[model samples]
Target: MSFYLDHAATTPLRPSVVDLLTQSLLTQGNASSVHSFGQKARQVVEQAREDIAAAVHADRNEVIFTSGGTESDNLAIQGLFSSRNPIGGVARPIIVSAATEHHAVLEPIEWLAAKKNAQVHWLKTGSDGRINLEELEELLSSKAEEVALISLMWVNNETGVVQDIPAVAELASRFNVPVHSDAVAALGHIKVDFATSGLAAMSITGHKLGGPVGQGALLVSRKTKLDPIFHGGGHERGMRPGTLDPAGSSALALAVKSAVAELDQSIQLWTDLNLRLVQGVITAVPEVKVVAVDLELGTARVPNIVNFIFPGCAGDSLLFLLDAKGVAVSNGSACTAGVTSASHVLLAMGYSQHDSSACVRISLGHTSTQQDIDAFLAHLPEAHERAKSAGFTV
Candidate 1:
């Protein structure tokens, strides 16, 4: 049997959500139109927004729907950057984030720095993938005026390492600097509270939580200022402009609600499976090095993911070998960035280039089962051994 463990990329959709999506697709109306049909469609979209907002403990007005996580990240980063005021006649263009963030957050910040004249303050992470909270404190204390916004991920997508987002938000707030978190990996894995998080914006996507692709929302605080990235009909309170999608909205809401409702059971199941997988791998391959294995509970890495390194193996080779054995995994954030190079996250955490290149990520989700994990471990030993024999590729 084929074992699929790449849930971080996207998850299997729920049949109920699929049904709602199909029903919404059959409904005839443009959400922006003023006609009766349009009004009906608008109701569906509004209901969805309300449901999703309730799921995340945010006000419905703060939810700005976008195409997906990447778009949400783009809108948050570029929008906030363009809207920041000048400090001493120079634009507040410094964007701060950790190198362990996913490409969705990293690329946009890098783009702003490379082409938009924004300066990026890269926060260094420890070997366990934990960011230096004191460094963030110092940065905000000294450079508050020059900093535009601080973007960070709620969870490291590859390693499942959870960041101290609340701490980050609190520090940035003290400096009057806005904070944006890409909570794509944290929504169902952890209970996310946007209203209480003190964030300027929080990005979330549908596909990550069993909703369809091309559906996401950016939770923008009412007090935050951001320019529109997509200009047109002035949708989403002038934050994101486009024709609102009732089907996607409704489907996303259902998926999120379902995931949230089942969170307790899901977490228990994932934790067991992850511990089994991690312990089994360690026992089977004594050389395996687990990332963030000591992350404390209640505020540590999510259990759905396990990142590890096979000292002398190429991550890509092991990935392909596992695929050949009908078990699938990723090197790290495969969909967001090319896996040809060593992981920037590992490098940022001070892992050697060789170990970084040999790292792989296995992520689980709602549909994962013990049998699927058994299938994974069945091939992991041989894959690791063969990959190590093949040696590293640059």
Candidate 2:
């Protein structure tokens, strides 16, 4: 039997989302149009927005639909930067973020720093993968006037380490700096209440929450100001300009609703599964290192994801071996065109390049079961042995 443990990459879509998407697709009209047909579509889109907002404890008007997490991230970063540092206005050049952020957030910030001359303070994390808040306060205290925005992820994509976004937002509030969080990983897995989060903006995607892959949104606070990244008709408050997809939006809303409704049950199941998986790995391979194991699960870290480093084994080799055994898993790092590299997140957390390259990520979701976990554990010992023989390779 094929066992899929890489749910953090993208969870399987729920049947409800599929049914809603299919039904909505059959109905026609652009959400931006004013005709009767368009009005119907608009109603669907707005209702979806309301459902999603209610799920996240956000205002209905605060949700701005986007293509996905990457686009949402780019919009939040670039839009906020442009608005804060206007053409002929006072310069707020500093961008506060962490080195362990997903490429979606890191790339845009780096682009701004490289092309727009924005200064970036890459916050350091301990070996536990949690950002040093005291260090952030020191930076904000010194350069609060010059900082445009602070972008940090609510949960790390690789290690599932949860950050205190509210604390970060509260800190930024004192200095009047807008804070944006890439909450794509954290949205459905944890209790995410946007109203209580104190964030100026947050990004979330559908695929990670068992919705359509192309659908995602950026929840912008009413008080936050952001210049448009794409110029066109005033869609999504002029921040994201394009005809909105009612079908995708509805599917996303259903996914969000369903995930939230079952959050408690899912968390408990994942917590148990995570414990079993980690324990199995440790028992089978004594050299296995579980990342963020010391953190308090469901608070300091998420329970759905567990990253493991098999000393003397290349992550890619282990990944291939597991796949060969009909167990699907993912590396903790990015894979580009068949080339595997060390995870930046692990590197930022003080892991050596070798250890970073040797880690694999096994993430769970709603569809995951104890049988799937057992299958993975049953096959991992052999995979580990073979991978350890293969050694580390770029």
Candidate 3:
């Protein structure tokens, strides 16, 4: 049987989500229409909104629907930045974020800087992949007024490193600066309470937590103002405009609710699987070095993802070798997978270019089992040796 270990990229939909989606797809009516069928459709959407809000400790109005994580992130970054810097207003054009953030966050920030005259202050993280809060405080202390927003990721998708978003928010509060987080990788993997997170806006996607791929949300606090990127109908609090997807929304809501409810059990299972996978890899390939191994599981890092570097071996070689052996894995972000470059996350975490390019990431999810891990381990030694023989190329 083939092993699937790339959950960080995307996980399979839950059975409940699939059932709800199938049912909703068979129904008809537009949520914006005024007829009885419309009202029924509206009810489905509203209930889904409420369910999603409750799942993340947010108000129903706070949940703004989007296509997926990329859209949510783009909206949060560009929308918040625009609102923070209005025409004829004081220039708060500086954005503070980390370099290790997914392209979803990084690209928008880069666009703002290059096209809109915005400045950026990238936060540095240590070798463990955790952002340095002191550096952030220093940046805020000097340029708080000029800073539009501090956009950070709640978790590193590649390495499973958790960032202290609450602490970052608390520090930004003193300066009255808004903070936005890309919580795409954090929501189901950790206890993410948006109310307690102190963030002005946070991005989450349905697919990451076993929901439909095209559905996601940006939880925006009432205190936060956002300029719409899509300007059409005044839907989603006039922040995001489009026709709503009742089936996708219902499935996403169910997925979020289920993921949150079962988080504790999921963590326990992943912790065991993580240890098993890491230990097995080390035993089979003694030269393998586990990424962020010094960090405590379920606290500093999520237990679902385990990144390892096989010295003298190219990550692409190992990835292909594993795939040929019926094991699927990833070298880095699936968004940038086909592009042959070292992982930006690893480079930001103090890894050299060689080490960054020489790493593989194996992420687990609800479908993961001990047998899956065993199959991966059983195939890994040959893959490792073959990859090493090929040597590092990228």
Candidate 4:
């Protein structure tokens, strides 16, 4: 059997979610229609909203459906930045985010800076893949009034490093700056409650949590002010204006609800698998270095992700060899997989370009099993040997 280790990139839809999607596809009703069919469709959409909200501990009205994570991030960042009415006439609004954020967050911030004259403050993270809270406080304390929003990811996509949401929220609260976390990697693997996080908004995608692709939600607090990116029929409380996909929403909600129900068991399974993988790899390849290995267990990360670097070995060559052995892993984020450039996240963590390019990421999920972990371990040595023979020595 093929071993799929790249769960961070995406996950296969759960069987129940697939069934729900298939069934909902047969229903005929536009969510905005005034007839009985429309009402039924609206009910399904509302029920999905409620399910998603409950899974994330958010109010049903706070969840706005979107195409996926990228769109959600864009809407959250741009919507907030654009809606900022200058308090006391500030020239340019400042946006703060960590240097290790995903491209979905970084690219939008860059655009806002270059085009909209929004100032960008990139927070420096430590070697363990966490933002320096003291530095963040210093920055936030300096000109909090000029800031529009602070966007950070709940978990690092490549390294599985978890951030202290409460700490960041508290910091933002001190200055009354809104915080938006991209929780795509944290949703199913950890307990994420919007009510307690004190974040103004968050981004979550369905495919990352065993739901269907092409669906996601932005959880916006009722008090958070945002300008709608699209203006039309006023769907989603005039925040996002496209015809709602009830089928996709229903599948997403079902998957999220089910995943949340099994969160504890799933986390334990990931912990077991992570330990097995880490121990086995270290034994097989003694020179390999596991990033963030010294971090306290269950404190700095989700149990599903482990990243490592093999000195001098080309990550792409190792990835191909592993693929030939029916083991699917990744050199970096799937979004930037084919690109030959080094990882920006690792660079932000102070790794040299050579080390960053030599790194690989393995992420697990609910479907992972011990057998799959064993299969990966069995294939890794040969893959490393082949890569070494190909002049990619560590």
Q: Is candidate 1 or candidate 2 better by TM-score?
A: 2
Off by over 4 Å in 2: none
Candidate 1 minimal-lDDT segment of 10 residues: 332-341
Clashes of each: 0, 0, 0, 0
lDDT per model vs. reference? 0.89, 0.92, 0.91, 0.88
User: How far is 90's C-alpha from truth in model 1 (Å)?
Assistant: 3.8
Which runs of model 4 end up more than 4 angstroms from their true locations? 86-92, 333-337, 391-394
Candidate 3 residue 159 C-alpha distance from true site, Å: 0.3
Show pairs that collide, candidate 2: none
lDDT of 2 by residue, 1-394 (tens): 7999999999999998999999999778887788999999999999999999999999999999998899999999999999999898549998999989999999999999999989998998899988888999999889899999999999998999999999999989998999999999998899999999999999999999899998999999999998888999899888888888999999999998999999999999999998898888899998888998999999999999999998888898999999998999999798789788999999999999999999999999989999999999999988998998888766
User: lDDT of candidate 4 vs native?
Assistant: 0.88
* Candidate closest to the true structure, highest TM-score: 2
Error of 4 at 14 (Å): 0.4
> Candidate 1 at 340: error in angstroms?
1.9
The TM-score of candidate 4 is 0.97
- lDDT score for residue 257 of model 3: 97
Q: Pick the candidate with the highest lDDT.
A: 2
Q: When superposed on Cα atoms, how far off is each prediction in RMSD?
A: 1.7, 0.9, 1.2, 1.8
